[model samples]
Target chain A: TQLLEQSPQFLSIQEGENLTVYCNSSSVFSSLQWYRQEPGEGPVLLVTVVTGGEVKKLKRLTFQFGDARKDSSLHITAAQPGDTGLYLCAGVKNSGGSNYKLTFGKGTLLTVNP
Target chain B: DAGITQSPRHKVTETGTPVTLRCHQTENHRYMYWYRQDPGHGLRLIHYSYGVKDTDKGEVSDGYSVSRSKTEDFLLTLESATSSQTSVYFCAIGNTGSPDTQYFGPGTRLTVL
Candidate 1:
């Protein structure tokens, strides 16, 4: 089973459209992160939410951490073709120490048509 | 500096052949990881090392092995390459005690025919 499940496995929309992606899990996490991956490259960290019920915004993208710490969401405002790529959500458990492995979601492949 | 580099950006090998991908870091972060990316499967952790010579398995550890003999080098080896193992491999380095935001390498595309 996937510890972190991302919805809308694939998405394609015209520029200026708004979209939201969801990441859910039954397990609580110490923190959750969002990443964007382009072809021939590794996933790049977009943001990390450490507190439950926390919300963070990165210009056109807004991220929310669930109050229960079991889920998160990413919303893109006025999406652009530059947003075309795979968006991934990963969760980290509190391992007491700094050494913890991140569980990744299959990711949502977003295509913003120009 | 959190600079992570993976060698052999692209490779193609036949089945039953041995393949090794190397991850080198200048961060000296004491933690290194190998992950494989496959279509519709996301990025799955293959192996991770907390320190030199101390490695652990991840969700998909079968048919793969790893070694970290030094702080800056971690190696992932496929004893007998198979088509199923063909995927883009990434290396990451991070400090264990901080926020643990991992820095990833460009990636190595390995194709086993």
Candidate 2:
């Protein structure tokens, strides 16, 4: 199984509608980061949640980290067409032996049509 | 957009041929990483470097290798390309350790026939 799994593999909704993307994992992480990617481009960092139970807001986006640091969620309020993209959540694990790599989820493809 | 530039933005090569993709960073960040994106696989790290000549394998390192002879350049090479190796590759740089924000390069799309 993938270390990180994102739910609602695909989502389509009308403009001004709300949506949520989830990322879950069986292992704990030191931090979790969210990124968004448009077609034919690299993913762009949206936000990073470090402490457990942390909540961050970026304009119409709200991000929350699970208390166990094993999962995260991203909520979009009144999404717009401009918000259409692939949402990915990556969890970072420090293996204690000079190894720290981020495990990425399959991603949630969201389309907000006008 | 992170002062990172990947060479050969797009390429089509044949299986059994060798290919090299370059990732150059002007930010002089200490951490550098190479990842590949596929349909069902979001982004899998192929390799990463902490400093010059210091590299480590990632989850999807098979069929791929990397070198960091210089701090600014990280190279991902397919010694003998295979059709399964075809995917869009990305390079990223970060100032600190994991969990730190990473700036990504415009990705290089490769097709192995």
**Cα lDDT tens digits for candidate 1, A8-99:** 99999999999999999999988999999998888899999989999999999999999999999999999999999999999987554668
Clashing pairs in 2: none
> Which regions of candidate 2 deviate over 4 angstroms?
A97-99, B97-99
Residues forming the 10-long window of minimal summed lDDT in candidate 2 chain B: B94-103
* DockQ of predictions, in order shown: 0.76, 0.60
| Predicted candidate 2 versus true structure: per-residue lDDT over B1-113, tens digit per residue | 67899998999999999999999999888889999999998899899888899888888899999999988999999999999999999999876544256788999999999
Q: What is the lDDT of residue A10 in candidate 2?
A: 98
Candidate 1 chain A weakest ten by summed lDDT: A92-101
Report the alpha-carbon TM-score of model 1 versus the true structure: 0.96
Per-prediction TM-score to the true structure, in the order listed? 0.96, 0.95
Q: List residue ranges in candidate 1 displaced over 4 A.
A: none
True A-B contacts kept by model 2:
0.58
- Against the reference, the lDDT scores of all candidates come to 0.92, 0.91
